[model samples]
Target chain A: MRNLTEEELRVVFEKLAKFIGKDIKALVEDSNENYCFRLQKDRVYYAREVVAAAATNIARHNLASLGICVGKFTHGGRFQVHITFVTYLARLAKYKVWLKPQSEMSFLYGNNVLKGGVARMTENTPKNQQVVVFNQSEIPLGFGVSARSSLEVQQASSTDLIVLNQADVGSYLRDEDHFVGCGL
Target chain B: MDGVEVDLGSLSCADVRPIFQEETKQELEERIRRSVEFLVHGLFTLPEQSSERKSQRELPEPFSVIPRAKPIPKEKPLTKWEQFAKIRGIRKRKRDKFAWDEGRAEFRPIHGYRSINDGSNQVILPHDPSLEPGESPFDLLKEGKRKRIASNRKNQERNKRSLSKNQLPTHALRADKRSSKSLERSAKIVSISNRSLGKHEEGKKSKQKLSSTKRSLKKSIIPNGVERERTFQAVNDVLKNF
Candidate 1:
């Protein structure tokens, strides 16, 4: 694992801020332990400083994964957050959407959440904002880009798309091969 | 007259007298007059050419009598290749300026403009067995030619640098002065503030200078909370503009 370059760091931070907003500071400056981001084979890992340092002893090709895999930088240099990053984002997400029980399975099946599927959403959530998706019991399922803001969602037709699904917990099984060294 | 001898080539006459002979000033002047008269008579008797205007006596070619004004210059020092050639007893042979090119079926200049081997005119290059699978011969040839041009340019730059180091210290100092420290610092700041921090800029020489300035500005592992605070501020700045 290596330290992210200034350019890569800015991209990662900006993408993270889109979902968590100002809480990126809390993510970096955790009170209990020091956490830092390390990059290995284009995948950015969030790990304790000691763990990141110790993992350096392993050869690059042999080492599959280290700490929690947050995201991977695409070949085009865009940062793409993975489904595994849901835990952290769910905790600090500024806006959230809760899916009704009947439509949760459809969302897990990689389909966009329609207006009728959304049980509730954070008030005043802006349009096209990144938001975490949760069930009625507050169990984080996935994350998506909001197609309509809270105000617009009230007026939107039932069949109209409310949230555009980006990544979901169902990817754990569907994309199992991709997450081989992603520390599960 | 019997003791005098004359060299027509030098226009000079030498008179020989006995060592014990004493002569008065009038006798000396009379002897010189007789010698001069004899010389002029001999000149008139030799030959004559008549032109429309006048008749003139033809004179024989004169022997050079005067010494040269300056000494002969020393030969220049031999170059390395010349010295080597001399040691090996190699004699240079002149080659013809033009060579027959079989492909063109005509004689062409061996070097310079429109040379036979310039490759620019080739529409189809022979396929090479060593080329990788799926690789186009045309693209490979182009890449190789580009690499050769780049290397040639690099070698030329190296030669120029060596030449400047050996012969143009004042010129090199003037170049340094032209890119003064304050000017360079301002340029660096401008480059850093430009879109993409001037990372996509073209100039190879100035790129090195810009990177050095960037390295100096980069913070080296600041204390944990301080860096977090700095990142927080940067995030705020981005969010404020967002």
Candidate 2:
């Protein structure tokens, strides 16, 4: 894929900075044949992704931050961008939401990781339907997009990265609250 | 109805009639007499010898009181060991106080030096080598080493005290002996009061911090599309807008 235009790169970094609170140090076109953007900051690879360049122009705009991986090397390409992004999205969707008050909500997390928070499509789309939206702002802050084919029992197989369906989502919440066997 | 007279053969009528009348009267009297005699004999005659029954009925006599012998009391047997142990335990308890004081002192001396020396010396040195008739050269050498160590420790402790002359006696010695006797009781009251004050202060601080945080979280919204910094950025954005 051709390199991202200077203007396009700037706009993407701006969106990223607004969401992440950190400026993009560098942006480079990835060596992979698929069109992916490699975001560099302070000489460290922070995030890299396949820009979904074709999807960007199609107007089916859902900016999906699939997953995050700590860089194993200084050079950006050590990890695959699209796979990592998908993993990150699945991880975010796996976060369970506690129905308790915020004071008790602290139990859902360790080291300030937001563990219990519910995420649903803006329009409550049916199971297996794809949700696309422009920019991350359209999506809830604590919630993220699902890249897999179907979210099953709140569990997406590693091979099949589906968004977790609603019943499974409720089941996860019930299990997390230690009320699994309460016939939820 | 005719007055024709019937006469016996060759008998006159008057004589035959009178004689017939008298004989008839006599015959009737004899029959009546015989019936009377049969009735009187039945009345006088009773039961025959075979019909009579033998007498066997009897009645009980008055009752009398009888005395019984008094029962004897039996002795409860005692085991030899139980009696001996009871007597031994009483005597041992009386003797134990002094032994326990000596044992505890040997077991745990307050000064580390003494405790270590006491333990090591007991293992290495003879209990009372002098009791043996022959005195070994090693025994004298060991005794000399122990004496030197004891003197050196005593001198070092004195030097340490002199160096820290300005330091107050530890809290332990400052309390009077009588007060120290009830140290745990007084310490309990002091600790309880301190803990209560500490808990109250902590509660107040947490409540104040929570209210301020809740207000801030409610007002803030992350400015950009980034997910990571939203919480902190939102707070900052709210503060900036406010």
Pairs that collide, model 1: none
Q: Mind giving the per-residue lDDT tens digits that candidate 2 earns over A91-148?
A: 2232322222441232222212121222322332334332221112332112223333
Count of backbone clashes for each model?
0, 18
| Residue A144 of model 2, lDDT score | 28
Worst 10 residues of 1 chain B by lDDT: B165-174
What lDDT score goes with residue B7 in model 1?
52
In the range B1-242, model 1's lDDT, one tens digit per residue, is 67766556567765675533577788887778777776776676776777665556667776646587999975544545567899999999998889999987999999756887777667888878998999987777668778987776655443443323122332232232333344444445555555776677667423534435323212433444554455556566656655
lDDT of each: 0.77, 0.33
* Ten contiguous residues with the weakest lDDT in model 2 chain A: A64-73
Give the CA lDDT, 0 to 100, for residue B60 in model 1: 78
The best candidate in terms of DockQ: 1
lDDT of 1 at B193: 55
Best candidate according to lDDT: 1
